[model samples]
Target: MKAPPPNILFFLTDNQRNDLLGCAGNPIIKTPNIDRLAASGVRFENAFCTSPICAASRASYLTGTSEKRHRFTFLTSPLQSAYTDISYPATLKMAGYRTGLIGKFGIATNGIVPSLQDEDAVEKMFDVFDNYEHWTEEGYEIRQPDGSVRHLTDITGDKTINFLRTHQSDHPGQPFCLSVSFNAPHAQDNDPRCYIWPATEDHLYAETQIPEPFNAHPDFFRQLPKFLRETESRVRWQKRYATSEDYQRNMRGLYRMVSGVDRNIGRILGTMDQLSLSNNTVIIFASDHGMYYGDRGLSDCWQLNEQSIRIPLIILDPRADENNRGLIREELALNIDIAPTILELANLNVSDKMQGKSLVPLLEKKKVDWRKAFFCEHRFHRADIPKSEGVRTQRWKYIRYYEQQPVYEELYDLRNDPHESFNLAGDHRFSNHLKRLRRRCDKMSAECA
Candidate 1:
């Protein structure tokens, strides 16, 4: 027999990487809360986000489907809600759990929220948590990648803590699903100085000495294929908000952002424990996607490098789930898996329409024959840029483009070329391997479509 469902505490940070924290092996980041969580629960070393853009990636995370299927492919575009079917919160509410969201709701379901169409669903999903309305001042500017200036991490953290305290006293024993989505260190926001970091200007040199990975020459574009280089060149100039010391300064800021977010997580977790919600509540910490902290001469990631799409996913299931409490699953897992996992853990029936498989059984050691590969993609962002997709296996990564008349693609043998500098897509040495990956991506696309 199954134990009663525990409350859900989901934490999400923006533009984060799996390798940025001290627990994940980065000595420079100071993330004690996340480190503590990693020590006590399952740490998925190969977690990947379905996409990199804030809108598309978030849409996938929320709906348990891909961008192409959700049709909310870019930030400003409206979403087609039915394609992905039931959301994590909506499903939980249907199963008798109270639901609430804190911080930024990145995937704005256009003007109307069909999932929240019922009065109960709307109240269950949005009634408890506070977003920018009360969190920010009337005249304060909303941060943008091109011109951002507010210190959002502190504000976001405070607001999240407050929301939890309010609800902590409201429902003493009933089960609930509460999620806090945070924006930190993302490249699209305004200028870079508004966000705080751990290392100051004086300590930058000693701190960021790891140096840029492949494409060692930030100027390696001249050798790239024509259409591919054109997109890379413009992306290079924007600098993705890292302006001072090339990739080094960008990375220093990134490390600062992750460490800062970690501190906030510590605050929220501490409050939960104080309220006695920690022991029974399940805590999940992850990012929308990984960051490109100067890897492959790529400061901002829209690529398939390990540092780009792979992010940190740590699941701290309730005290009683027992099977593999502190285990690490090497299975290839992606973002869509999260929605269904949350649903299944709450004792809700995972909708057949859900493209993701739940992670509960894997946590309980019941899923021995899991998946072999994870599929992801980015579509129609810059009108001039092409649609892109990535396939991640245990040791290989392939990213292809639908840009010109011919498909322009990139393939990397992770064991030999982890930095992903050389494009082996057209190389004769690995044609068979590349073809196999392309076929898998096509099948996933057809399934989602």
Candidate 2:
């Protein structure tokens, strides 16, 4: 007999890198729940976000397209209605799945950034929507009857648990796709006390010393061009990493925030098991993009480097064979591939308009021809942030800032210099290699556009 469609529990985090969890080899962060999930599932070692910023990357994850195709960034208005129509949630709803979204739907729409009060816009996509932000300083949503405030991460877990309980009671036979987006570990840009965490997690990494970034030396910052040195990335770095004291305080806060989120994930997974849904639920955990801690003296994500673009992706299908459990895949995965994966898992056809390919074959261990390289772009043009595009292959990367005066380019051979410390673009010995990659970048950009 054919099995019923599996439920989906998609978890997303903001400003989290590919190596922040315990399973990813970070010794300090406490993420036992996520680590266990990775141990029982498939972890993609080379997952990346096409755009290394929040709004654009989140839109790409929802719409299954490149940021160049979606065109929703800081410079643009809300995401277009056409893209949302093909989104995974909307498509799953059309296929009779109960859909819910909790916490931090960061994509803007309808001429304004959405809040929890915006029901009309959210209803078209999610049947149950609860949207909020970091709320570390001013705004908050949940207050206990005892007059104590709940942290946003805790509130997110509560909402997800409520959805599962309600679904079991009301729609016992129907499957659900619940998306939980956590706004933890992302620095409150306006506040000087950046990277705030729940008070409950204050003791997580109190005494542990965070190792200094390998590229935190002044020489690395000196290697950057004047335009990049003057950008907002550097300004943000000054606020968080200007001194050793500030770096220690902020890094500990970041670690605690991540641990807080991990704690809530444990609660959510426990609820799924208690409700007898674990055997039929597929959980996908990932982040919108990555963060930088003094890497090249930068603190935020916008550049095309590994620290900014690489993100963690874990998929756990409980129905898969026991032998296939805990498998790791090395194929390159992108945020855009998420929508198509969800659609295929739900037994729907991937839209021709979607640029991402479904990862079902990879999950099933099928021999297939995969992409050798993928194109990445950032279009959030500002005085501090410049527009740029690039192509990243397995062994090489080429980035060009077309908007810069005289057009600056950067090339790195990833095989030898995995840290991307040396630029080979200007070397006469690699002129032919540079020319080849430049042409490839241009061709891929045009095709993606």
User: In order, what is each prediction's RMSD in angstroms?
Assistant: 4.6, 2.2
Q: Candidate 2, residues 196-292: lDDT per residue as tens digits?
A: 7877897778898999975789989998899999989899999999999999999998899899989999999999889999999999999999978
Residue 79 C-alpha lDDT in model 1: 55
Candidate 2 residue-pair clash tally: 0
Q: Pick the candidate with the highest lDDT.
A: 2
- Model 1 per-residue lDDT tens digits across residues 339-433: 98898777778777777888876675545788777777777457545567867777778788766568777788887876676778888989999
Models 1 onward score TM values of 0.85, 0.96
Range of the 10 consecutive residues with the lowest summed lDDT in candidate 2: 109-118
- Cα deviation at 318, candidate 2, in Å, is 0.3
Candidate 1: stretches off by over 4 Å: 1-3, 75-77, 83-85, 109-124, 133-150, 192-210, 232-246, 320-323, 365-367
Write out the backbone clash pairs for model 1: 144-189, 144-190, 145-188, 145-189, 145-190, 147-190, 148-190
